[model samples]
Target: MSYELRDHTADVAVEATGDTLAALFAAVADGLTAASAESVPATGGDRFDVEVTAESREALLFDYLDRLIYERDVRLVLPADHRCAVVEPNEAAREGDSADPDAWRLAAGARGVPLDAVAAREIKAVTYSEMALERRGDGWYAYVVFDV
Candidate 1:
């Protein structure tokens, strides 16, 4: 997984690419955490599971990141390491004509330290502007904008 932070007028942006949807999500999550913390260690305090679902890929990403920010603000902690898995409909779903937007979901676990120790900028919220989630060749790529 790889990600880069881009400059935006009053917000911050993150563009990430991965071999799979889950990897891409993980990268973005890492980027979000990095934006709020200088260094996220591989091992830390406690662990928590986060689960989210949305209508589309882009919505799913927005919800996922927003969930992270919510957790940080409420629980006052940051993840040092995380693992995620995204379940999405395949070409097989087209054969069934299922339009259930709730079918797409992501499950993840974050491990880390309390928010008091980390030093970095705070992300206000996730934004839809300049957001993209698409398949590029054999991998997946995404661009997310944050209201910093």
Candidate 2:
């Protein structure tokens, strides 16, 4: 999983690439953290856990990213490394109302440093404009815009 900062007209953008859906999610989450700060601890920090559900993959990506922002803002944590797992419908899932909650869910955990303790940028919010999450060929790609 990897990410690169791309130029956005006004906001900050990141292009994430990975071989699997889980990697893509992690990369994008890492990208969001990268855009906000620099030189995070390689490992071993406070644990950050987030679970989000969305009807579609695109929305899932959006929510996942937005949640990262929320976590950073509220908890003052910046992700240094993360792992994501998608519980398939064919596999075991946490009990919830199907009609009320979205079908696809992501359970992710991250380890990051405190934002206040690091040199960080203020990311205002995540935007839907120019947002993309899709697979091409053998790889997955995600593009997200952040209002900085």
Candidate 3:
């Protein structure tokens, strides 16, 4: 997993690339966390699970990041580590499956922290107005604009 930070016209931009979509998402999360804290130790003892569906890969990526931002703002949960599984649907509807319209499933967990301890510039929210996620060669890449 790997990611890089670049300057954006409006918000901070993050680009992540990985062998798999799940790995790419995990790297994105780690990058976001690093923007605020000096370092995120792999010692989160808490767990969180979330399922979100969108109309496109870009939307799905935005939703995934938004969920993490929600946890930061509402629950004060900052994830230092993440695990994701992309659920592929078959011709027949799968049980416990909702119409995602998109092509991914992003369920993950992270360690929790106090809201007061979170940095103010880490990320305010995940903006959908200008977000993108695309396939590149054998891996996946994503661009997220955070409200800083």
Give the clashing pairs for model 3: none
lDDT of prediction 2: 0.82
Give the TM-score (vs. native) of candidate 3.
Answer: 0.80
lDDT of 3 by residue, 1-148 (tens): 7988767776777878989888888888777777656655455346777776655556667788788888777776675677776554441146455464335555676666554555546677767655667789999888776777
Off by over 4 Å in 1: 90-102
Full-model lDDT for every candidate: 0.83, 0.82, 0.69
Candidate achieving the largest TM-score: 1
Query: Model 3: number of clashes?
Result: 0
TM-scores, one per candidate: 0.88, 0.87, 0.80
Error of 2 at 24 (Å): 0.4
- RMSD to the true structure for each prediction, in A, is 3.0, 2.7, 2.9
Better of 1 and 2 by lDDT: 1
lDDT of model 2 at residue 22? 87
Error of 3 at 99 (Å): 5.8
Candidate 1: residue 20 lDDT (0-100): 95
Write one digit per residue (lDDT tens) for candidate 1, span 1-148.
Answer: 8888888889888999999999999999888887777686555679999988777888889999999888888888886476889877563265462666346778998875787666757899999998999999999999999998
Residues 104-124 of candidate 2 have per-residue lDDT tens digits of 778998886887667998888
Off by over 4 Å in 2: 88-102
Output the number of the lDDT-best candidate: 1
